[model samples]
Target chain A: LAKTTQPISMDSYEGQEVNITCSHNNIATNDYITWYQQFPSQGPRFIIQGYKTKVTNEVASLFIPADRKSSTLSLPRVSLSDTAVYYCLVGAGRGSNDYKLSFGAGTTVTVRA
Target chain B: EAGVAQSPRYKIIEKRQSVAFWCNPISGHATLYWYQQILGQGPKLLIQFQNNGVVDDSQLPKDRFSAERLKGVDSTLKIQPAKLEDSAVYLCASSEPQGGGGNTIYFGEGSWLTVV
Candidate 1:
């Protein structure tokens, strides 16, 4: 399990773009970067995942540098509904049963209306 | 398809009492995990099971906590002589078998427990 460090909290207004960076200096070669969003009273939901470079989906984009020591999650046009705690996890690639997934304190993003 | 299912959405018990939580994973998911989340903190993995076999339980408090997944379908987690610190949300999650590109794990609404 790779330890990850991220901001404790971030503030953003509607229609603004929010970027949260996570540092995993000890990330392994087989590890993948994944981001999850968790709203109050609900479980964390998968937002995006990537091995390297950049990966985009309907909700967000993940940008991983060539070194893969850190990654960024970017959300475009934020709204109040997007307010939640976002977790960044670094774990082995798919099908690796030995991987032990862990979670950090996570970055809480408060989207203001 | 339905998501993970957990029962006893809320539970309140006195210290030294016993409590149990049940979980039903998504229809074909082979991997199941139990996590504990304290207020203002991230979730901690307590146990993980792959098709009724224990995968990882190094974080689980073996003395007071025990879990089992019979028949590899439904699972149960039990806490005996619960302490105040045991008061937290118990979350159940499941993911597909190892392999393929998508190994995304899905979680269920957690079961909130309060130890008085």
Candidate 2:
């Protein structure tokens, strides 16, 4: 499993864009980068995933460079409800027999009104 | 489209006592996972099951913890002689294994355990 490093917490204002970067220098070749959003007393929800380059969904976008050593989760037009802990996970393959996705401390995003 | 369901949203017990948690995955989900989440940290995988069979139990403490998935549907996890360190949330997640393909995982609200 690749260990990820992210900021403990970050603050942003409503309607502004927020980018959370994760460093996984030891990420495996087959590993895929995934981001999840978790609110208090709830489970983590998938936001976006990427192997390389950029992948975007209705909720968020993931940008990974050629090296695949790092990835960034970009949330556009954040709202107060966006306040949650964002996790960056690297897995060999999700939902597979070899899957046992590990998580780090995660980045806590505080969206101010 | 019902998500994963876990029973007993919260539990309180004394050290060395026993406790059990139940989970029902989404319809037709073949893969199930159990995780332990401690305060101020992320979830750690404890076990993974596929269709009533154990796929992985490398991290599970077999000495005191056990889990079973019967008929490839609902499952239960039991911890006998629990310790204070076991005071954490137990989460259940499920997914349809797609032959190493990427699929979003759905998780239950989790069973919070407080072992004093």
Tell me the whole-model lDDT of each prediction, alpha carbons only: 0.92, 0.91
Clashing pairs in 1: none
List model 2 lDDT by residue over B1-116, tens digit each: 89999988999999999999999999998889999999889998999998899988999999999999999999999999999999999999997745555656789999999999
Worst 10 residues of 2 chain A by lDDT: A91-100
**Candidate 1: tens digits of C-alpha lDDT, residues A1-113:** 88999999999999999999999999998888889999999888989888889999999999999999999999999999999999999987667765556999999999888
Fraction of native Cα contacts kept in each candidate? 0.60, 0.68
Looking at model 2, the pairs that clash are none
Off by over 4 Å in 2: B98-100
Q: Can you tell me which runs of candidate 1 are displaced by over 4 Å?
A: B97-102
Chain A: TM-score in each candidate? 0.97, 0.97
